[model samples]
Target: MRTTDVVRAAGGCVVRVGAAGLEVLLLHRVSPDEWRLPKGRVRPGEEPETAALREVREEAGVLAEILCPLDETEHQFTDRADSQRRTKRTIYFLMRPLSSTTAPTDPDFDQAVWLSPAEALARLTFDTERHVVGVALRLLLGQD
Candidate 1:
């Protein structure tokens, strides 16, 4: 029997803090319409934190300041091909927008919105990502 191992990739979570409290930036996938944080695969020769920041800008058209250390999550799921098991390693960092004027760009996200922590938690589709969001929320609110 041949054993196969899939490569894992890194990602980031872009968040914003404001007077209304901490709000997470969420994007709706074009196909599924599932809401999620702006994230993408870390490119070759890219630092995880840098990739996080780049992904946020590319996916959401937002430039933000990374405020804290990175948090990560790992899980096994079917690959995009849906024919093999793959582990996704997502590394996240808390970020604050430099300015309030920002919106997601083309191809990455169809729509973008800011949501309260509770609403974000409720709207997110993945459990692990949601947990990451929770951690980011706590960090942003100084609850952790």
Candidate 2:
């Protein structure tokens, strides 16, 4: 069996639930024409929660507060760049936007939008990511 290790990363699922309804922040990947939550690899010496907050700001141009525990998922696939098989263990945190206005700041993402949780889950490219959004949505809505 080929030995493979899981890489740790942190990300945020920012949800704004209020009179406007439950809307989730989604970002389009620069290279792949797919919608996803704002996230990235955890930097060395950085805590996962801090990395999650940093990623949300860096990718979505939004400051958010960690509202709940980390939602985690693991995915195995070939690395897009090197084609080496690998597994990425992504730690996703539920966050609420601190400000009313938010946008994508990372050049890696071409666009950012707030959509209903159902729509976001349907539009997400990765199944694992979709599940993460579902869990985040439930947690944010106090249904979990």
Which candidate has the top score in TM-score? Answer: 2
The residue pairs in collision within model 2 are: none
lDDT of 1 by residue, 60-123 (tens): 7788778775578777777676578776677778777775766777574787778888888999
Candidates' C-alpha lDDT: 0.74, 0.84
Q: What tens-digit string does per-residue lDDT give for candidate 2 at 61-100? A: 8899998765788877787778888888789998889977
RMSD of 2: 2.3
Stretches of candidate 2 off by over 4 Å are 1-4, 80-83
What's each prediction's TM-score?
0.83, 0.87
| lDDT (C-alpha) at residue 56 in model 2 | 89
Cα deviation of 139, candidate 2, in Å: 2.1
